[model samples]
Target chain A: MDQPRVGLFVTCLVDLFRPVIGFSAVALLERAGCQVEVPTDQTCCGQPAYNAGDLKNSRSIAQSVIRAFEDFDYIVAPSGSCAGMLRAHYPDLFKDDPEWSPRANHLAQRTHELISFLVDIRGMASVENVGFEAQATYHDSCSGLRELGVKAQPRRLLATVEGLDLNELPGAETCCGFGGTFCIKYPDISNRMVADKTADITATGADLLLAGDLGCLMNMAGKLKREGSTTQARHVAEVLAGMTEGPAIGEPEKAPGT
Target chain B: MKPQSHLFKENAKKALNDANLARALNNMKAGFQDKRRATIAKLPEFQDLRDQARDLKNHTLENLDFYLSRFEDRVTEKGGHVHWARTPAEAREAVLEICRSVDAKTVTKGKSMVTEEIGLNDFLIESGLTPIETDLGEYIIQLRHELPSHIIAPAIHLNKEDVAETFRENHTQLDPNRRLDQVQDFTDEARAILRQKFQSADVGITGANFLIAETGSTVIVTNEGNGDLTQVLPKVHIVVASIEKTIPTLEDSATILRVLARSATGQEYSTYTTFSTGPRRPGDLDGPEQFHVVILDNGRSALLGTEAQDTLRCIRCGACMNHCPVYGSVGGHAYGWVVPGPIGAALDPGLIGLEEAHDLPNASTFCGKCAEVCPMKIPLPKIMHHWRVKEHEAKLSPPRFRQGLAMWAWFARRPRLYRLGANAAIGMLGRLGAKRGRFAKLPLAGGWTAHRDLPAPSRGTFQQQWARHKRSQAPSSS
Candidate 1:
């Protein structure tokens, strides 16, 4: 079979906050026998606009995204929240438009979150020759867990790792309250929720915490740092690609030994 | 009842600071979720049943006017009267008229959220009638002059010790030092007090879980059997229910009931799934002498063909709230309305107007757990989004928020500019926080900084790094 050409939709959060996750995703896809390209025209997934109920801007942003990545055999994102925006919500944005609706629907069909695409579509059983020796737990970002059904794909890949002990976080599927603008809009409620989430994360006693979506990862990592807990947070893609040499998310920019 | 939904943020903060309420909410969070999960896992056909229930509700809602008329006709045929109420005022007036016809004095209520919506208890009290709540939770909250914090579990925000205090203050005749330490003790005390109110009441009002058009029956499902006594012992039984509660047939009610109990409190079936069709008939041993059904629209009719129509399919299971992290954190009273949690967040804006209920739809994290657990399969997050659209359109959101969104969207549409801007912003942030890797505080980000440190970005944007990496990778080949 010909190698599938995949367009990388490095989400806005990952693009700005942690580009390493983007690189990690490319490494995983290539290792799984796929050619990957990060389209230059891609910027954001229009999720901020879409979530804020700004449909007019969400449509224009989505149109730009469609035009940029429509030619690829597949489109994948490291974040499920952005991938869900492209795959699940983009079509609804143009449902009534005769011209853009079909194009949006077609793009949505080809879109996938990185881990689910790696496991379900690409039929990649597990990461080969990759090992991370640490006790870690995974938090299921809401969109990835519910909208994209990405519950076990990450675990399936992590199981192949030689020395990773995956202790499941309590309420792993609960939201960490990094709801784009929700944290700012209702900060108190969001704080209460993320506080509980941090409590649960610390209780797991895992040194490292992992999740697919960068937004949730950053939120949890920030809270953990504020609480002065030693548990580190990182995107799951980084661990899967055996790219844990650098600092974990929200940590000083230096290798541990150095 | 007066709709403090506008103060949602303030209410949520107050609820968070409440230590006793926090303890109560934590207990509820663990109890309801585990029970629902365990009950749902045991039933293989649960998912299919949920689909069927959703379809059934969709069908009935599409033909709501017709089924409602059929319900009225069936009730009339069985010597019962059905009154149509377009607003809460009209519904309250209709109930008052029925009570007046029977010269009612003391009225017993059996956990009717619709009555709360219509402000029936306060209205009755002001109009010289005594209204007594019979449901244990409802009774507790009523004595405290509070609204139902949760729809199904009225006093869920109260711990047992809080209840003991409330009972000690109100039940003045009880032995002052009687041991009310245990759960059974509280229930026994409530039962003894409510029994007299049940016997002396001239009228009883209850909410219908399902109103069957086929048999003119109104169903009430409860664990305490208080509703059975509330309706059966009264001379006049008035069921206050919204028009959306109507179903075409008794069998349709059965289909919904299968999911309702499993979704609510995780029972195979509520202890008493009692159905009352009409007034007492000849030779009937125990039943109401007069039966009146007040079918209320109260802003629901406007949702028939709109984006929020799916919310009308809600069975009030409380599963959404049970699984909701926000609801679990702040508890239900913070929603500041009759129905709370996801259902209130989605439906309240439509009922109470977006300007007043704007904060509700915005309070959620869009976790979609509510939609996932909804037995009716209502897209609750989607409905909330619809309200957000309306809120934005009305310019109800703070101008600062809208301006920030506009600025973000404007920059995002231009890929090159967005890349450059992001690169510049991230570079600055990355440099400032390189030593610590996170910011303890940041300007214009107090909301985030107040609770958690903001993680600084990597040194540069991904697009910039990707472009440079690509050039290096193909240095000689290209």
Candidate 2:
């Protein structure tokens, strides 16, 4: 029936920085027997602008995103914050537009963070295992856990991954202080908070640090490298997709042109 | 106690950006936060303590009517009095009545956020009483005629040089050339000035950090011991505090204290956590003749059983602000309220109306640092999101963002058209900016282009590349 389609929103950061999360999401979705379709016009969830007090531009981008993804039966996003923004923030963003408010609610009701959608909606909580192992700690993305309540979704999905050992990090719910523009605007204070967060990661003695959002991943990774620590960082989708085939953590963060 | 945050920021900016002020703020940060961290690290049950503390606050807020009644009964049983203030005006009126009855000309005050909450100092000054702030930081700001930038560290944004200037300006005889370099020097000077006020003042006022339902005791925690002097040295002791500060028992107060000082200054406990049950008992040499507890509701009771109810859990530790990036930069004054940071985001809506402070919740990166470090572990970002939702429901956000959501809701419900439209748009943007691979200018992207470059998407978007891969993987296609 129409190939039982699904739409994957690989947010801007994922598409630009780590393409494999997109691939991993596709692999995992396909294995679940749903034909995954990524709608490309998704420049961003408009989170950067939305967060930076740029409502008009964020609305324009949100409009573009909504127009692009309108037809999907189920819209799945790999990043919880982006998905949460769409489900949680967007409807609020459009409340006054008499026509858009109800419509935004419609999509907000249907949208899901990847793992939660897989387990809760698609019953992929006990999905077929992909064998790959690494000792790692999970960083709970703020918008995802606090905004969307996906704390259990990723854990259940990760539990299905073969050979992975999980350790708890101190202050697990704490922010890595990758406050988007905050990092650039107040880099000194941002670095202090990130250093504290990375120290907690190291104390876990886990070989890797995994999280749902790339904004946080980049922050933690930059601090890990700057402090010259060895623990690597990757997205939760990348780990579940087994896409860690790259230079180790301290490697020159793949220069953009290359 | 501080005034509303709006005036605080304007004054603090003048202080913080002044090169000398920056040198002072930078030097002081390490000592306060580092010592705080060392204190918190030694406490093994910090997180658990926060949970218990948060639960205590929730319990108190839920049964506020009961606790207030019990506290009133106990306060009266001790030959003291209890007065209820539904609003800040009523609170000011009750305090004024006591002052007028006693023919008080001068009032000595410890750092009390509740007094700040009700604008009591200005009201008393207007009524012709010279209110003296006894805490060194509060005294310095009082001399400057400014508001507290922070809850605990009222003068955190101010440095030693600024304090010396304030002293030089206010205390005409103080030697400006005396090299008042150390904070200790400034503290000692302020101490000497306030010691005189404590002796001469007829009435003392302070804010209670917690009001225990079991003992009907009002608790105040401070490092300077000024709160104790304010209560004990005067003939009359007045306590102005919010209803939410009441907990069922001292044990509960103890639980919250674990997270309070740690989340605030990273201290396991402040030097002083004093509790005053009532006036001095018979045979006590150092105590007040009369005691009064003014329970101010303002806007707290309305918060109970609402989506924003979780904010009632805040112990006002100031951790959320200390660790908040937005707060660290713009500081508390920009929030335009007494409470700032994640707590302020929730509170501003209730106090100022959701419309005026709509941007506060949206101001966060949702980085979750505040929630993490919070002693009470309030789900700050979640409450902020709840505010965002309320902003929408209340039509507080600008019209454009809502319309965008409505349109997105429509397209997000479809699939084939979604893919086709997405691909076409990506392809168009890619081709339009192909040579540059980055758009230097886009009329609609004024907000985005202002800050950072919006890089060009690859010609073959993730979807296009993925489609080819899926086809290649299909056995029939291969």
CAPRI quality band, candidate 1? medium
Provide fnat values for all models in the order shown.
Answer: 0.79, 0.10
**Residues B70-181, candidate 1, lDDT per residue (tens digit)?**
9999999999999999999999999999999889999999998899998999999999999999999999999999888898999999999989999999999989999988
Worst 10 residues of 1 chain B by lDDT: B469-478
Model 2 lDDT, residue B338, Cα: 74
List residue ranges in candidate 1 displaced over 4 A: A255-258, B474-478
Tens-digit lDDT track of model 1 for A183-202: 99888888888899999988
Off by over 4 Å in 2: A1-20, A24-77, A80-258, B1-37, B432-441, B474-478
The chain A TM-scores for the candidates, taken one by one, are: 0.97, 0.91
Q: Measured by TM-score, how close is model 2 to the native structure?
A: 0.74
- Quick one: best lDDT, which candidate? 1
DockQ of each candidate relative to the true complex: 0.65, 0.13
Model 2 RMSD in angstroms: 7.5
